[model samples]
Target: MPEDLPIGRRERLLAALRSRGSVRVRELAAELGVSLPTVRRDLALLADRGLISREHGGASARTSAPERRTDGPRWVVGMVLPSLHYYFPTVAQGVKAVADAAGAKIVLRGSDYDPVVDREQIGLLVARSEIDGLIVAPELRHPQAPEMLRWLDALPLPVVLVERQPPSDFFIEQLQWVASDHRRGGETAVEHLLAQGHRRVGIFGTDNVTGMQVADGWRQALRRHGIDPDEQLMGRTGLFQRDARISAFGDVVERVRKGTLTALIVQPDPDAIALAQRCLEAGLRIPEDLAIVAYDDEIASMGDPALTAIRPAKAQVGRLAMEVLLHRLRLGHDAAPQQLLVRPQLIPRQSSLG
Candidate 1:
């Protein structure tokens, strides 16, 4: 074998300092196969970075301390979101901006909107001691149930809920959560259509909590307007499926052709865009043939006929979640749980009106 190359001096010095609180310059120099002056220089640089403190003769390890009421952790912030789709990426960017200012690193994972995957990712994060805090977009309807809450309950650091809420009552009291008022968003969309004189409006969504809330908003709004909601106009797509989206849109188009639906409220921009396409292909003119208002305002920029949509304040949600999480980190355990409701705005386009 070739002669064993010397170990990096920085690695050797770090290992020595970790085992013992303090290490002499000569000892690190000898162990690292470097000169005494070089070892001292390395320790001085480490001290400058606040990684360690140097005494008259050597350097000492840092003691583990809880975050102060005004100062956040000097480590990592774990962030778990549902997906990189329509809105979550914007949330990630917002978190990144806050993390940059706070000098904390962010670790990201996606649930793909699946509870099982979310659980697995959460378990992996909780197992790591390097993670200082957790910011999660939890699935409201999860099959794992108690095990999931048990996992969250066991974490030592502050757990902040972002965007979506879990079903557990304990988390409701223990966690700081920030989300768009999706129920109000649903109500706003339906109420807009109703105000414009559309009585038999269709509501389409997934079976997820956010979806259910949006769907329920439509029903409640219709009830408020003295219109009996049509169950036939209600439809669900699988959590994340392109084919399910196509089928769902097709079903809605068939209903529209039969004169059952005069307006529609669909969640997220993906399904709304798909629905718009199917309606156009079926020889239906928007607003004249059928009116649509999507949950996310993304589609208004895409096509010739822009989709009228209810735009969730994604950037604001992301900014507020980070702000609350950072506040919790600085204030520690005594800080009260915070709940923020950011409003969603309605953007009207050609798809919903003349």
Candidate 2:
């Protein structure tokens, strides 16, 4: 059998397992004349299909039928996110990719940036016992977040959070979550600015949890560079309040003119774009007068001069959230809760070329 063909390799692996009852990964790799990773992947696929049972360093033939329902009852997973547009659609696509591959049905719902709505949507899924697991991206900073998480913890089905973490005060041992390293993204942006010789950098953050983490990263980066963080240089704004964002933009421009800030990091693409426009209107050239870095690379490239941005692995987060929930569903209460953080990449553009 040719090892180059996956079907051939898998068939060979099954034959070897059937004859030997069990086989170590290295032994299988040597016998199949395939790489260790290739053998491991084949073993995983066979295990996923209930054809074998995975062991510590090997796999064994299943003596009885796998616990999965194969006749008619398909695994149904419920997914809830904040929005279907911008930033979340890619995540939803990732989730769908895994669900489709696993032959599981996904019931997706969108919430309106409100924790109450998140609770309502999740409750609806819970009431329907047909749902086997849930993947949710709720507004964890909301006032009702603790109560909502408490309620979720009590649910019988497995739940995995997407891009959200529980409050520091809450003790949730069983809760699992996947999120981007926003704080590290912030620090990376500051490091890039500092590398470009920008002193007295500023941050325009949002009021959300993601924004808070970015700000924390920014602060840490500044301190590491021996620059004292200025409270006046850090401004917080609401996500969708146009008037408030405009005010914050004006404040940033004023600081730039006063020579208090040479570079700035604005979060969530919209605010960054607005600030860039305001800077241009105020007769300040980007990278020359005030270097700019935007978080959430969604629309950063669309800006004039193409703003430098932090690109979070949102799709990976979504896929991992689904995978985690599925693992919990399969392994039940014995599965250890997973806290995964995907790192963001820094995409430099003309906006921060100085």
Q: What are the per-residue Cα lDDT tens digits for candidate 2 across 195-307?
A: 99988798888777788999999999999888898743887745324566346666666777888878989888888888788778779999898998999999999999799
lDDT of 2 at 195: 95
Which candidate has the highest TM-score of all?
2
Q: What TM-score does candidate 1 get on C-alpha atoms?
A: 0.73
| Runs of candidate 1 exceeding 4 Å displacement | 1-65, 68-73, 168-171, 238-254
Model 2: worst 10 consecutive residues (lDDT sum): 1-10
Q: What overall lDDT, based on C-alpha atoms, would model 1 receive against the true structure? A: 0.72
Top candidate when judged by lDDT against the true structure: 2
Q: Per-residue lDDT tens digits of candidate 1, residues 1-354? A: 111112244445544665576889887778777787777777776565444668888988643334432355475778889888767898788888888888877999988878777877775664454666788987766556555654554344567777875543554435677888888889899888877778778877867667887877777888887888765387764422455534566666677778888898877677777777767777888888788888877665584478888988888888888888777777765677787888789888887775
Provide the TM-score for each candidate, comma-separated. 0.73, 0.76
